[model samples]
Structure formats: C-alpha cells, structure tokens
Target: METTHSPIRPIPVHPGLPVIGNTLEYLRDPLAFFRRLQRDYGHERMVRINVGGRATTLMLKPEETKQVVQENNRNYGRGKSFAILKTFLGNGLLTSEGDLWRKQRRLAQPAFHRQKLAILAETMIEEAVAWADRLEKVADNKPVNFSTATTDVTLRIVTKTLFGSSLGDQLDSLSTALANLNHFAINAVVNPIRAPKWVPTPSKRNFERATTQVNNLIFGIIESRRKTGETRDDLLDMLLRATDEETGEGMSDEQLRDEMVTLFTAGHETTATSMAWTLYLLAQHPGILQRAKAEIRATLGERSQPSADDLRAMPYSSQVINESLRLYPPGWVMSRLSLGPDRFGDHAIAANEGVLLSPYVLHHDPASWPDPEHFDPERFAPELSKERHPYAYMPFGGGPRLCIGNQFALMEMQALLIVLLHRFELRPVPGLQVTAQPLISLRPRQAVQIYLS
Candidate 1:
C-alpha cells in the first residue's frame, strides 16, 4: 500500500504590482474580486490579499468564519482593516478590544435597552412622518435621488433618536462633517498609515479637520446634557449612569467620546446606507413595492401616523428589509486578526493572521441562494422552510460582539419604510446603475434616482 499524504490546499491569489498588492484593483471593484476568488478557489479556502505591501490571508468559509466570529473569538478586533477609522472613532466600542470595549458596551447598553427603545419607537414614527411630509411638499415633476432621500431621513431619525428632537440644530454640521470624514476614512484604508497626519494629503487633512470639528460638537453635546440636572430618557442618560458591576466605576469623558463616535458612525451611517438601498430596491421591483405598500397601508391605516405597535404588524415589510440586507448588507466586510497558530480543517492558519468574512459575497452565493440575482424577498420569508447555513446570512454578524444596534437598526428601517410607502410610489430612473462600493460598509456607489410618484 502506498503511503498517502494530505492534499495540499491552494491559497487563492490575483496578480498585482509590487508593493501595491491588489490595493488599486480591490478598491476599484471589491465585490467582483471577492466573487472571482470564490469561483476559482473552493470554499474554506484562503485568498492571499495584497493591500499596499501587506499580504494577508482571507478565509471565506462560512464554517471557518463562524469559528472566528463566534466560538473562538477574542479581542482580535477590527485590526488594520479599520486602522483609518481610529482617526475619527478613537477607541470606540467598534474598534476597541478587551476591557475598554466591554466597558463601553455596558455603559451604552441602557440607552438602547427595551424601555428606552419603546420611547424611541414613538420618536421614530414621528420622524418618519416628518420625512414623508417633507417629500410630499416636494412632489414636483422632477427627479429625486431616492437613495439620498432615504439616507437623509434615516440620518435625521438616528440623530434624533439618539440625542432627542433638538438634534437637528446640530445635524447640518454633523452631516457635512460625517460626509467629509467618510471620504477620509476610505482613503485611510488605502493610504499608508505611517504618513504624517499633517501631510499635504487632502484626505488626511480633511480627516483631521473633520474629527476636530465633530469632537467639539459631540463633546459640547455631552457637556450640555451633563449640566442638565433633569434626567431625560435617552442615550446620554444611560451613558451617565452605566457603572461596571465589578469595579463600580463609570466611563470617563474620553471613554464617552469613543463610544459616542462609535455610535455616531455605526448608529447612523449604516442605517442610512441600508435604508437608501432598501428604497432603491423597492423601487426596482414594483410587485414587491406594491405588496410592501399594501402591508404598510393595511397595518397603519389612513391615520395621522404609525406608532411602534404598528411596526410589529407589518411582517412583509420586515421581510423586504431582511431580503435587502441579505442582498446588499450595509456591513459588507469585517476582519479579525488571529491570536495564535490555528488549524481550520487542516489549514495551518498562522498566528496574527487577518481573516475576513464578507456578507456581500456570502449573501450572493449561488449555491446558497436560488436565482441569486433576482429581487425575490421570499428568501427571508417567515414561511420558507429551506435549510441554509447559519453563517450564510450574517447581516449584523454573530458571536459575542454581534452588533448591539441590530434591533435599533431594524426598527428604524421598518419605520422609515412604512412612511416612505405612504408618501410616494418610487419609480426607477433609467440608465443609472447602483453597485456596492465596499468600504467599512458596503455603501452604494452613486445616488439611485427615482420618480416621486
């Protein structure tokens, strides 16, 4: 009998110029590149990614991804994947590892807890109506970027829900600052980290200016709220009261800034992006849009507004949101650095390795989703009984660090969708293509326009 050795595994790699790795190409089109890797290499395989002189192995296996994200997860953190975000976010819960992140999460939990969320639901409905009214006023025979409208509504809603109704006074500056910061954040992903912060690079300069302005604004808000003797039921109140059970110490101002920045970014931008895509998707598929509108109308009635309770009554609307996330999740790619030498089904993954899990790729997997490109919401239907891997559909992620704002984002989107249906029937503008621009989140490349019918 001949001695048998284990078959050598092939780590997938695409060609790139020296030092740049696949940085330019990957930036040009992330979704396509990732899909190519999946096609050429079998599942549970490795992809040697060259991102500006860095060579990292990205594993795309759902099982391996589950192991990394959930079971064996540690303080592996956002790693270099989000190195640029640190300039804007600092040691926020989204980027911080270990005790710092844990403490921040605890401090911020109450603001998003059940009771406060109930209050927020009412606020969400009010904001939704306000958005619809604004659109109703602008129902001229003109083209509108439905994506922009959706993003604006969600942004204002999240700001209001997190800080209360007085938030609009600060939102204009916050919105501009966020827009500037998002570009810089993306540049930070591609540019060398060692470069001086004051360097003439437009992105770095823009980042510094935006962060300073945003911090001043955020810190001012925190200070004003702290000075108020009256305790209001919002995120600020919860942050003030949160104390570590073991240490009985509250988070300091610096810690608060980190958490606030994290929330400001995660709390709004992701929700805005998701809502934007959802509105565009509903516009693209009229049948689905009609069904969603019918559900929203039946549940909400021709009433003044739809409250939080009304939200629970719209299941198909929720299904549409779920399907949209499945097809175009806001959080497209997240990576975790390995702690030690590890083995995943005989692959000798090394210590300190960077492993990536992409919802964009997994969501579009043909083997997993039938007629994957079709705009079918049935994929997430409550009635469907088909078996799919748990990791195959990770919109908010899994494991210990699963997105705490999962409930908040979903509720916010549901409210926005309901109001959108009442205001107008969106019809797609021709010759415009909307594709996922992969970043910290999978933001849409261009504003998707629609007729405000």
Candidate 2:
C-alpha cells in the first residue's frame, strides 16, 4: 500500500498595505515591528511579510533560526540583501558566498586564531590605557559622549593591530568616510528604489566620494607595505604572507584591500557599539558597576596593563559584556535568500524566498530567558548557560558564517572595560535618554552621555 503525506501549507502573512506591505511599519520602527510579529504570529514559527516590495519570512524560533543559519545553510545565500554592502565591502567574508567564501575564510582563518589574537592583546591594552589617560585630563563630572569616545578608541586599536601603524592625522577623515558609507548602505537597504549609480543624487555623490576616500586609504597602506618590504607581524602582514595550500597562491592587492576594509569596518564598529552599550548598562546599574570594578581591581591590582591571562581571570567582567551583547547586539538582524525549497514544521517555503533572523529577538525571548527585560549578567554564568539552547544567545551570530573577529572583539571589550573601569567611575548624565538605533549596527539613538570621575 502507498502512503499519502499532507501537503505543506503557506506561512501566515502579516496584514499590511497593498503592494508596499509592511515596509512602512518596518521602516518606522524595526524593533517594534519584530516584537509585534512575535506577539501576533510567533506560534507559527514563520510569518510572511512584504518588505521593500519583497516577501520575506521572519524566523521566530531558535530551532528555526539554527536550521537556516547552520543545518541547511547551503539552501540560503546572502543574495540581493547584501548588494549595497557588496558595493563597499566587495566580496569579503561577510558578503561573499560559495567557493569564494570558503576560500577566503580558509585564508583569513589563521590571522584570527587564538595564538595570533593573543599577540595583539598588548596593543589593545595600550590603546585602552591611552584612552583612559586622555579621559583623566577631562574635567570630572563634565558630560562626555561615551558612544563617540568608544568608537574613537576602538578605531585606534583596530588600525594599530591591522596595519601595524597608528592612524595619526588620517583618523578623522577615515572615520568620516566610513560613516558616510555606512549611512548610505543602511538607507539603501530599506529604500529599494534607489537612484542609479550614475544618477549622482546627493546620497550617491557622498557615497561615491566616501568610497573613493576609503579605497585610497586602504590601497595606500597596501602599496606602501609592498614598496617598503616591511613586516610588522600585524594582521596585514599575516594576510600578505598567507597562501592557499592547494594553489600556493596569495591574495592580490585588490583582494587584500577588500578583506582589510571588511575587517577594519566590522572590527571597530561592532566592538565599539558593544563597549558603549556595556558602559551604559553599567552606569544605569550602580551595583553591577561596583561589582565589576571590584572584579577588575582584584584581578589586576596596581597593574594598568591587562594581559590575555588577566582578561580570562575576570569572569564577572566577561559576564557583563555577555549580558550587554544580549541586550544590544550590534549585528541585530541578518538576511538571507533561499536558494532552494525548505520547510519549517508544516510551513512551506519556496526557492528565492527571503528569510530574516534576528539575534535581538532570540536573545529576548521569554521562553529562553525568564524576565527577559531585566538586566542580569549572571544569566551568562557557565553554570546557568550550559542548559540553554546553543542558538538562543547568538550575539556574534553562529555556524560557519559566524563573525570571524568574535574572539578579537570580545578581548578588545574586556581589555577596555578593565582599564577604563579601574581608572574612573562612570555615572549616567541626568535627564539623558539613550535608545537603540537600528543601523548597520545597533547604535545608541543619541550620544550616550556620562560623567567620568
């Protein structure tokens, strides 16, 4: 006898305006839109919604997310969602797909290994100490934008570690250019109807100019290194010296530039955002702040420089950073296009469909975390965390496409927090409100004002 199977059903669609669908609601407020989806249709595991004139399914469960990003990831690709990013990042690890991604990942893997990153910890601590010293000169109790401050310090750290040289006078220009490119990329992602590349709109002009500026800076570094025959043993030197085992071939200057810019942008932006949020949370919770400071002091008494071993010894500090990432993950939402048909429970998905996975949503799920809104670092304690689903708390993402620089970012944050907290006390400024702004990264909607004394 032959057996019959029930046909897969279409995922429920969220009601929205004709044609445009949920774009307005999404653009108006992305986080709220996600929460609304969770409230209204989360039981379905997947919900279809039109975003920017395309139908996409929002993955609502940890298991569903794991399947898309890990178990059956081959059926999904970066697709058109990353077109704007590819415009700037070229085919770097974040945006590349298939064999290219595999090859690049192989080549870049060695540069971010534990041993390689251990050597960079000294540079990270020095930069953090220098930042703390600069802050010491500022008037105590005066308000400072901690968000911008963190960005500046992280940028310096990444520049030194990546290029083996301080940015010096070029810092401001490079920062501005990268900011411009980031702004353009996010806007273009939401507004699908963008002017043609040659149209020369204000945004387009700014983007092109910024792209050129960044290109000049990166290519200049590569050219100078080649001409000087210098080996600083920094990330650049490692990439320069890396060769494919099969072909014994190395990355060309253009390839190096792509990977370098990808690392530079991703390296600084995500770490800075995480640090800013961590500092902000500590300011709001005085007890947590004090406890973290006590841990720092106990771990490194009278020692301003924190070594890799010192970082490992500060578990509470690590927990604080972990909790902050859970609350305000920099890479909040990720997108992929289906390359083949797939299924989630009884719901059917066709090839070419778009899928959205949000770490922010998963991290805050009440099912996985009781009293999810409450700030609690102890939730990440090894004893408690071992019981949770692996995909339930993916701050740096997961699977093969996980952020390559996750370890680097974590150590950078740990070093900065240890040095900065040891040197001064951080107090939130009165009457200042900070909210999450969903950009290329989840940034504070405004300057996170705080006082250092």
Candidate 3:
C-alpha cells in the first residue's frame, strides 16, 4: 500500500488551552468530554485534540472506526494507553505488536478453541454454584455487595481455568495488587506526564511494589507447574506444551510469566465487570428479569445446574447480557496510532497521530440505538440486530485484533447467570443508583448493593 501524495484536508480542531490542550478536560471526565465532542461535532466528523501536547484525532463514526480497526488495521497500532500498560503487562499478547503479537496470538489461539471452552463451561457452573452457596448462607435480608461477589467468583474461575489452581492463600493479595496496578495504569493514561519509574514518586513507588508482588506470584506458579510437570489440560498446560512451528521452541519462563499475567489481567476484570453490570441491569429491569428467568427455567427444567447445552438453549439470557454490555461495556474505549499517513473514509490521518474508537460513544449514539438509554434486550434479538452496522455493537471490539476470549467470556457469563438467577432474585438496595466509573473497564463507581431474596 502506497501513501497518497495528495495534500490532505485539515481535520476540524477542538480548541484547547495552549500547551496542555484537551488533557485536563479529558482527565477530569473522559466519557463526558468525548460525548460532548460527539454531540457538538456530528458523526464521521474528525477533530484534532491534544493529550500531553501530542496531537490525537478523535473519530466518531463507526465507518471511520472500522477502517482504523478492521479494513486498514495494519496502518494503525495500539497507541499510548497500551504503551503505559506495557510497563505492567510486559510484551505479552495484549501489549506486543507486529510479528511478535502475531506469533503469540497464534500459539495461544488453540487454548481458547471451542473444545476447551466447552470443557471449561462445567467449571464456570461449579464456581457459580459455590458462589451462590456462600450468598445463601449470608443472605439475611441485608443488601449484598454484588460487585465484590462477582469479582470474587470470576477471579476464582480464572485462576482455576488458567493457572490450574485457586492460587491458594495468595488469591486475596494478588487481587489487591492487580487492582492497584490497574488504577496506576489508568491514572498514567489520563495524567500523561509522570515522573520516571526510578524517581520514587509515591504512585511510582507503589506501582513498583505492586508489580514486584504480582510477578513473584506469577513466576512461582510457573515454577511449580514446571517442577510438577502438571497436565491438567488447562491454559497453563497448553502454554507449557505449546511449541512454535517454525522455531520449534517452547516459551521461555519469562515469556510464560508475561502471557500468564496478561491472561490473568485480561480475562478476569473485564468479564467480572460485565457480570456485575448484568446483575445490576436485571435488578433494575424486572420485566426483562422475569422474561430471562422464564427462558432459563424453561430451558433447564428441574435441573439446578446448567449444562453447556442448557446455556445454549437460553438465548434470552445471552441477549440480556448483550444489552447490558451495550449500556456499560467493560472495555469501553479502544485506542490506536496511525503508523503512516492514511485515509479512513475520506479523511487523511497523519502518521503518528493518535486515534480513539470509543464504544461508549458509538453504543449510545441515538442514530444507531434508538432511546439508547433504555434497557432493551429485544434490540439484540436476531432479526433486529441484522439492521444495525456490524461495528455498531462492539463490546469485545472488532477485527483480527478482537478479543480472543470473547466466546469464553460469553460462556462464562451465561453459566454464572444460569446458576445465579436460578437461586436468587436480585433487587436493588433502596435508593442507590449505579453509575459507570469508566476506568480500564467500565466498573460501577459505587458498590452495587442488591437484596438476594
């Protein structure tokens, strides 16, 4: 592909303070700022803004977003946000680019294959059952913090499926450390300017401590697996046995650590957040909840546990989750950098400029989703979804770089819902209104308190 020599039209500039540009406004409230930009400037209208004195092009239309992520994806690479993430995630599948990413993605793809997912479905149901049992023991008409509960169960499931263990007593500490690391990463992305890692700023020092603890735990898991020559048919086993077809070499210990941490970080939070939001949505919408229960009950009959086949039969359950994701997608924003001067739609994107593809903005766009604020699972009904743009509802993102664990995430969500909804009716804790935090994943800013009656 050749870069056209034709002079490119200037993208409309969003006026900002000299030097700092849009950094402060964006840092204060990114979703609000982006939504304002989208409303003021119409869809497909490109605008130039600055982050840490760097020029970034904010794209609004799904078509332009498609070009950046799918059609001309090669011309764009994971941008600044991911660069900040590399400090923690290292050169794993999430942070690596080019051939390294290609090779890593290929080697890991088989582990998430359908057969593996089908096998994992039973484990998800088992975890959900255990979680419900714990909930039942404590349900005394008091408001339960659903957010904490879902995160706890999801983390357990990920540890069992990926590491082949529950991570023993370190589970609590590891969760805390990962949360600290994620907070630091999000702050770094928004604040832009920061002291170097060695400078010993309070945040930097804390980040270093968190990284050290997480790395030790992950490396310990790798060592234990290697020493035992474990073969549980889990992700760790798949990775340990994986050999590059061309190089005919297995992953190094460091490489294995990187991938494990990547999966731990990637797999756990997003899906957990998705489930938390789904519960909140169902609680808020009783009609939708009842309809979903009807499908679940009708599909499962007398069985308390849902099999892989039972999950497949509950399409409404999936639709309810889908609709919740549209309203509060965990992975709300996707970023890219133009590798060279490129054309997306009719606009010329200059080399090295940053591009943002915000699912929050696109998902809520009135043109694409009518009464976008409403909780309507029917929108996802097969016949209705066909009318929308392929990229219009991107919860897990799109293109070759789309989330590899998409099916795994969905299956896990379905299993949890089947077991949870069967046992409990989640009602809102009086007067509390759940709000989106819009961090690394769109988490509930407040504790989502629900009465499990």
Candidate 4:
C-alpha cells in the first residue's frame, strides 16, 4: 500500500506591490478588490493577502467563516484596524474584549431586551412622524437628499430615545463634531501613513476639537443626570443603575462617557445608512416597493403609527430590510486576530494573525444566493430562510459578541419605513448615479437625491 500525505501549501495571495502591499488598491475600491479575490482566488476558500504590511487571511465561505466568528470564536480578538476606533469609541462593548467586555455585555443586555425596546418604540415613531411632516413642508420640485434626511431622523430618534429627551441646545455642535470625527477616522483607516496627532495637521486638529466637544457634551449630560438624582428609564438611567454582579459597583463618570459615546455613534450611524439604502433600492424597484406598501396597508390600516406589534405583523418590511442588508451591510467587514495556532480544513493559522470576515462577499456568492446581483426580498422570506446556513446572513453579526442593539435597530428601521412610505413615494432623480462608498459604514459616495411626492 502506498502512503500519501496531503500537501500543506501556503494560502494563496492576490498580487500586490511591496512595502504598502494591498493598502492603496484596497483604499481605491474595497468591494471590487475583495470581490476579485473571491472570484479569482477564493475558490470558496480562505486566502491570505497583505493589508498594511500585515498578513491578513480573508474568510469568504460560510462554514469556514462560522469557524472564525462562531465556533472557535474565543481564539480570536479584535484586529489592529480597530485600534484606531478606540480613540473615538473608548473601551465600550464594541471595542473592549476579555473579562471587561463580558461584564459590560451582561450589564447592558437587559436594556435591549424585547420589553425594554417596546418602551422606546413610541418615541421612535414620533420622531419619524415629525421628520416626515418636516419633509412634506420642504419637499417641492427639487430632489431631496435622502442620505441627509435619513441621518437627521435617526440622530433625532437616538438622542430622544437614549437620553429621554433631545440634545436640545447641544444638538448642533454635537452633530457637527460627530461628522468631523467620522471623516477623520475613515481617512486614518484608508491612509496607513498618517501624521501623529501632535503633528498638528488640519484633520488631526479638527478631530481633536470634535473629540473634546463630544466628551464635554456626554460628561455634561451625565453630570446633569447625577444632579437631578431621578430615574427616567432611558439608556442613561439603565447605565447609571448597571452594577457588576461581583463588584456591585456602578460605572464611574469616565466609563459612562465611553459607553454613552459608543451607543450614540453606533446607535444612529449604521441604522441611518441601512434605512437610507433601503429607500434608495425601493426607488429603483417599484414593484417590490408597492408590495411592501401593500403589506403595511393590510397589517396596519389607518393606524397613525406602527407599534411594536404592528412591526412584527408587517413581514415584508422586515424582508425589505433584510434584503437591503444582504446587498449593503453597514458593517461590511469584521476583523478578528487569532489568539493561537489553529487549523481550518487544510490551512494553518499562526498566533496573532489578522482574520477578516466579509459579509458582503458571502452574501453575494453565486453558489449560496442564486442570481446574487438581483434584488429579491423573497430570499429572506420566512419559509425560504429555513434552508440557509445560520452564518450566511449576519447583518447584526453572530456569536456571543453579536451587536446588543440588534433588536433596537430593527424596530427603529421598521417603524421609520412604515411612516415614510405611508407619507411619500420616493422617485429617484433622473440620470443621477448613487454609488456605495465603503467607509466606516457603506454610505452613498455623494448625496442620494430623490423626489418625495
């Protein structure tokens, strides 16, 4: 009998220049470059590529990606790319890991529970209704910038729902500061060779100013709440009361500030972008949009606003959101660093190697989703979704570290969609091209213009 040993070949790499490696190419167009890697080299398998001098492995298939994100999850940590986010987000649930992350997640879990989210649904609807009314007044022959409108509404909803009231006097300055910080952070991620903060570059200066403003605003809110010594049953109240089971101590002011900023930023940006893209897609496909509207009409006839119960009844609305997420996930790519030597099928993963899971690639794979480029909400229909792998769709991510605000975000989006579609039929501007620019979130490259009738 002949004994045969399976060859242990190195992971295939996509061609790129030395020194900077794939940094410049990736920055040029992330989605295309990643798609090329899958189309040319992936073979429905993991491939190693150079990213900013780091040997990064891209996991494109569902089973292998499940190994990284869900099965052998503990052996991975957040990647170096996330290090830049810590300056803005701090050690909140999104950035922190290990024991601290566990403690925080446990403490914050109850706040996003179904019952808790129901309490905030009315506020979400009120904000959506108010925004729709405002748009009705201003909308005319001119095309409205849907991106800006959606962001404004989501921001207002987040502020009111989380703080128990609007930002009031601090809204303008805080909004401007957050926008500047987002630009600076995305620029830092794309341009690996960046000057240190002390080097006094314009972007750096603006970032510092914005950081200070955001910190001041959050700290001021915490201080004001502390002075009042009253419980308002919002996120701030929940955070104030969250005590560690072992330590039995509440979060300090600094800790509160970190979590607040994390919630405020992550809370609104991703939800707004997702909703904006859904409307954009609906405009392109009138038949699907009409189906969605008909479902809403049947489920919630003559209701002024959708309650949480109404959201559950309107299944197509959820499908539309799910399909949009499949096409354009806000958190397009998730990065994790390996903790130890490991093997997935034939490939060997070394200690401390960066691993990435791109939901965009997996969702678009022709093998998994037939006619992957086609816009079909029916892919997520309840009966059809039963046969798909659990890991195949993770707009809110998977495993223990899944986003805590998942339920909250879904409810907000569903309510907003119901209110907006009821009031206006969005028509895309003629000859206008809207492209997805992959940043911290996948946002429109420019303003998405739509005529609200």
| Tens digits of per-residue lDDT for model 2, 1-453 | 995556788799999999999999999999999988887786787799998888999998899999999999899998576888999899899988999888888899999999999999989998999999888887366877888898889999999999898978787788889888888888987676777677879988888899999999989989999899899869999999898887888898988988998999999988988898999899999999999999988888887667888988999999999999999989899999999998776787889888999998898888888888788999999989999999999998899999899999999999999999998888888777789999778999988888988
Residue 100, candidate 4: alpha-carbon lDDT: 84
Q: After superposing candidate 1, which stretches have Cα over 4 Å from the reference?
A: 1-21, 191-194, 197-202, 383-386
Residue pairs with colliding backbones in model 3 are none
Residue pairs with colliding backbones in model 2 are none
Superposing every Cα of model 4 onto the true structure, what RMSD results?
2.5
**Candidate 3 local lDDT, 410-451, one digit each (tens):** 999988998989998878777889888888889899998889
**Inter-residue clash pairs, candidate 4:** none
Q: Please provide, for model 1 over 112-204, each residue's C-alpha lDDT reduced to its tens digit, 9 standing for 90 to 100.
A: 777778788887888788888888778678767766777777777767765765575678888788779877777666555556655687666
TM-score order of candidates, best first? 2, 4, 3, 1
**lDDT (C-alpha) at residue 191 in model 1:** 50
lDDT of 2 at 20: 94
Question: What would the TM-scores of all predictions be?
Answer: 0.92, 0.96, 0.95, 0.96
RMSD values for the candidates in order, in angstroms, are: 3.2, 1.8, 2.1, 2.5
lDDT of 4 by residue, 393-443 (tens): 888888898999998898899999999888888788878877899888888
| Backbone clash total, candidate 4 | 0
Q: Which stretches of model 3 miss by more than 4 angstroms? A: 1-8
Is candidate 1 or 2 superior in TM-score?
2
How many residue pairs collide in each prediction?
0, 0, 0, 0
Candidate 2 wrongly placed segments (more than 4 Å): 1-6
Error of 4 at 216 (Å): 1.5
